[model samples]
Target: MCNHLAFWFGKDPARMDAMFRRSGLMREKWERDDYRAATIGKAIEGTPNVYDPNFGRRVGIRFGTNPGPGPGVTSGFSPPRSWDDPTRLAEDYLSGRCVRVVIDKCYLYRVDSDKPERNDCWEPVSDAWMQSDMWQLCVAAALQEWERKEAKRVADNEKAAQDAEENGEEAKQKKPEVVPPVFPAMVNSALLDTKSQSRLFDDTKLGTWIDGDPNAPHPVRVGNGLLDLKTRELKKHSPAWFSTTKIPAIYDPKEPYPVKVLDLLKYVFDGDDTRISVFQECLGACLSSKLIWKHFTAFEGDGDSGKSTLLNLILLFLGERNCSTISLKKLTTEKFAAFDMYGKAANLSADEAYFESADEGRLRELTGGDWVYWEEKFKSGFKGRNITKIFFSCNRMPKFSDKSNAIWNRLILFPCENVIPADKKDPIYMTPEFWEGSQSGLLNFALDGLDRYLSNRRITFSPKIVLAGERHRSASDSARMYLQDNFVEKDHARVATHLIYADYLDWLAVNGYKGQLESNMFGKEIPQLFKSAKSQTRDGVRCWIGITQTTSKEDLDFRRNIHPTNKERARQRENDSRGHTSYGQAYARLVEGNN
Candidate 1:
């Protein structure tokens, strides 16, 4: 039987030569006759490359000096036919021999071809292939290997972090958790769990809550934990008042308070013991807002008298969020001005007293606890009672149209008299760090005052304070000055209302008092200054009795020379009642009496 190896090799020797050249396995010399003779000899010798009836032919081709079977031939010397087997092709990808390229989410490619122009050699690996039972089984095997490597990497990182922490080094920063918006009704306890708890305090009564016992039922909720106010140490928690934002109540109870009460008082009041006491009382009243109710504080002084410092200290004690800044003029003049005062425990004004006129009714209502109607731009008007304590630091005292003593009664004046010297001024005290450090001491001091006020229900003032208040009232009342300068006390003596009003206008202009009251308004305010006097229009001339005008030079000279003696005042009153004592006659009588 002739060897039919040519039929098995196919009738394409040139094609076989081209494949060998491309694979870099071409021999130096190759003739079809030599190839056929070698194959026939191997078949006859029953070599490994010889044909077997059960397993088919094992054909081996020699490429140069290295003898090996070509690609498709089933010979032990030939490389595995991975391109023909899908499992082998996938395995090649896992081994990293085949470059895996993700084309899109749904499809990927295993690129075996290096040619840029043609994609014919690229194998499309679809999501469908990954989802198939056979491919899934293959992927599962690959996933196990990958998971093992990932687990080792995670363990190594954790070990490194642990070692660093043990060595007192800063560990890697973890991702931050999201914070929720704070609610108004929530308890602001440092220990409370903010996420789980639906409520913090039982009721909305605003007060300080310090963490007490660990096991006790906490009265306030802070950041998702309950703060037991009964058993926990007060010093552990910081001092914080009710504010729009949450502040930690961390205060060092042991540290000495940096600011001395007497020093502060001396700085603000300039050794005026009267003003110092009144300021203390005012502070107490402000601290114990619930107990003291509606009294407001006013600080009047020249620049650099520590007015802003004193107010800033009080505001620091109250917490910045608990206070708002608004001019007293705005509150009394603008309709919607009170809106800024909502949720604030204190309202501060450092501006100069610019508003010459104020609505007395509004000022009264604010301090009298009447519901104040306030409106914001593009919003409906709302009404709320003014629980906020009003404080003002000004070069000039605020003026009001309401002559009734209601507004005066609510005001507590502290005259800042000590003008700080340029060389002695300490700017560090105004910094936030100084105030923050003193918070604990200041809070304790305020609490003590609050306790005293709660027990007594009164802010006591010194006799000097009473006198000072009167002086302030007199200074503020333009009519009081008019009464002092233009009128004299006499039983039958009277002053023309028009003349008195004219004198008042002149006094206002000379003293540089802003704004003017009409004659009728001036007449109305006179009764407030001199409560004993009564207005009467006699024969078309409006006059006030027992208050004679200094119409003549003799009357003016007598009024100016009159001393505060009962006998002399009585004689002067008699002379005035008798009618028209000329200046010359009065001088002659004085000279004659002396002789």
Candidate 2:
């Protein structure tokens, strides 16, 4: 019985009851001692009586003196007798002697509950019991109880909600909706997609508010409204404007600026008011390359003139990533070099090398907003149009091979003539620390320039700059120089076209000028110099009738001394009859007269 109880209830009756409760079995209120006693009593009282025919009508017989040897039992053999009577077995069970009773090889047992049998209320003790239908009943009961509790909980919740709604107390006790924080927009315009921009900003606005920084596409400091460039309408600002680009806190318009606008402009332009104005206008154009097309800037100065420093400040002010570096030589020599300018607001080159005359057409195209094809390494070529504003700084202007005025018309030169002495140079001006410290002031200055450019719609150049450009053009062309020196007005003595061409070539060789133009080219360019001059053929000789060769003092003296002899005059007349002069004879007479 103890072993059976250990296997069924895990060695303790209290544990058995706890397991039943956990499984929702609803254990009955009964002590283990009273249950054991009642179970043993029932088993004993239910025992049946046995009859022995050998005992001669006695139901249960005890072992008496056997009457000698019976007929069935020979000598030393006796009739079998019951080992113990049923009454004695019953007494042993009541006295607790026989704790367990076996009937038909099975343990005596009974369910202790007094109520009607509920198969669902019983839990299985082991695998054998689980295989029976009782374990399924227990599982079904557990699930049903769970469903009941859930239904009750839901009903209570619904009732509470209904009661609150009817009383109007929910409105008074409700929590407020939370609003997320707003931050500045910071993203490069080149990187942003149209969908993203539309979602962040209002589509209707007067003028597009472009943040001056090329690296940062989003506006960090904006007023209550912004303008739309495409629509030309004003729209209110939205708090949803957000981007990954980080704007420094110093750029806040609400904060005090570190440097005054005038002082900042002076620092960049070195107190040259003309340069300052021109540069500011250019800077404004750089802010929005799409608005202004054509026109590039050239900064002409030697080292230590602060031109490079000025460029660095501009790059810092505009976001360095928004600018790209490219050499003029590359722009002309490389087929796909223009690809580098894609998505860039400004392209800067310092100390650029000279370009051949062939590059002039490409340079014009770059500034003129023409579509150009470019290819990257190991990729297919594509066509793209760039509006990138160009800036070049060099010690001297590049020599252009094109004689046309196309290049000159588009170039705006700012002569940085003020060289900073070594003693007075500011070592920290170009340092990173200086850029970080003065970013706010520089941004404010650029904003003012932007406003001015938008208002005027065009940049105006000073007279000094115009003169400088002309000088620059003249210095590069030897043909222009030769014409200016040797050619005179129509009132002077006329020269034949062949003689002038010969003199020009000789002058080029003597001066060691490279890449001299051919005679046909010279003929084409001469008309530009003497606009009123016309060509004529006299006796089959080509001559320019209107223009004359300028007479130098030495040539005039030679002519004065040569009251040409009658012999020389006859020879000159004979040569004139042949439709051209014998230059050798004319020179020999002059030599004779000098002697």
Candidate 3:
């Protein structure tokens, strides 16, 4: 595989994989040993660019591996603000609470390195000169802090003496000079603490939006920055609010679509414009804060299909900074899974299988943009909300235990139908360097979708996509699909429980579904799907009321005869609420697969 990935990425396999690492592509370890060297992007020595929490922006930040203003030029701050005096910056640094520090390299690599055994390690440094300089810097910080305190004490004493003399009383006793602790202890006390109220940045300090506050107002992030949803433009700067991270996607109208990405997407969607548009809009939506209209996306297909290609492209489009990976099982069961997405713009699972959700409520909380209570090891619980778009793909849709329309309502399913043969699968799509050239174009492609979504405020799924989605979602809960396929509503009806359960098992097995609920749970949840349905006893046998069971092969045969014409597909989209339920009568004409 590495031998063939030579299309414009050059012959260096490690460099190709290094680009993949920087672009956030996850790969298995079955490849050549050179692939392991991908982390060289991390191991390579590089200075970190300077970051100022005080300004919440990069100042003279020369990012990447190149050197910038390292500590050698530590006379004053790197970029002097018009209103900020460089002398004041120097004074604050001397006093050891200037709130300015080398958060990143003087000029650097991202600070995502593995933590050392201890912060103050001597193993990485053995040279006398460097060690002496480090010790001198720490001592200087402490001495400056002590001198600053002594000067303040003397000034306060003078003020007290003057006030006492003005009132005709004896001067007050002077306060003692305070001892300055080590730099680490000073940090613990509140000096240079971001948690202090003096900070220039904060979370959601942009604050809530809606006056009535029906659903939580998730401040939207879009395009290049936090979006002013009303104005449909990048939000103007606000001192009260700061987004900890920005979506790296930049919208430029003049940029064309990434040729390779567009080609693959068009092929995967079968050139269906509606499905393609939904995908594009979905890509755009991931850059924003949680919007209820922004439904979680499920790419349903087998491995050979373009699911991985499209999924990787999406990861590249979102950028590594704003993305997190957590599978559905983890997000539903792991206590701290949701917290993994604290400030992320998107959460994706590379591969997920359908399972009975351990906590459907957590899934709802994540997808609904409701306030989620998150906790991590040794940390107090933090309650917060995010607009992190959720995406996952599966070859075979999981058989879920859920029996409600809620989970079904919060999804936009894109059927990955077109399969790429093993011999024909393109290695270039997975090549990390391929995306760098396409970045601007991909950004614009996503921006086009954002414009459409901002205009209408919702994504419309095509009928074909609806049919595909319904088939997959219904496959997850076979009991419900069985109800749709082999039953109909009626005023006078009673089907024996044994008879209903017996055929349901046959249908469930025949439909390739896994697992079954006991008769009691099956009977318990039936009413949820059928509003008028009820269970009762008749002739000394358990029975269902208000709905009749029908295993008529005739309807299934008739369904096989009818094709999905343009008119039929258009009819499917005519009723948007058609997803919640399609009765057996309608199911006869619209039934998917062998049902």
The numbered model that scores best in lDDT is 3
lDDT of each: 0.51, 0.52, 0.56
The reply for model 2, stretches above 4 Å from the true place, is: 1-271, 354-358, 435-458, 488-495, 529-595
Give residue 479's lDDT in candidate 2 (0 to 100). 82
Q: Give all TM-scores, in the order shown.
A: 0.49, 0.51, 0.58
Better of 1 and 2 by lDDT: 2
User: Could you arrange the candidates by TM-score from highest to lowest?
Assistant: 3, 2, 1
Worst 10 residues of 2 by lDDT: 97-106
Candidate 1 lDDT tens digits, 1-595: 1122222223234423332333233355534668745644544443223212222111121101223577777777655542223333233222322122211211121122233211211122443453342232233333333445555666777887898889998666333222122222222221122111212232222332212233333222222122333332342222222212222233344545456645777766667765654565555445432343667888788888888888877776665655788888888778877776764667888855755567878778888867666566555555556667888888887665556688777877776667899998888667667665565565445445555555666666656555656676766677765676666666655565654564565456555675577777777776676666788765455668666654455653444344343346446545643544543344334324323
lDDT of 1: 0.51
Relative to the true structure, candidate 1 reaches a TM of 0.49
For model 3, what is the alpha-carbon lDDT of residue 219?
A: 41
Using TM-score, give the best candidate's number: 3
Clashes of each: 21, 10, 8
Over the stretch 100-125, how does candidate 3's per-residue lDDT look in tens digits?
Answer: 11211010112222432111111112
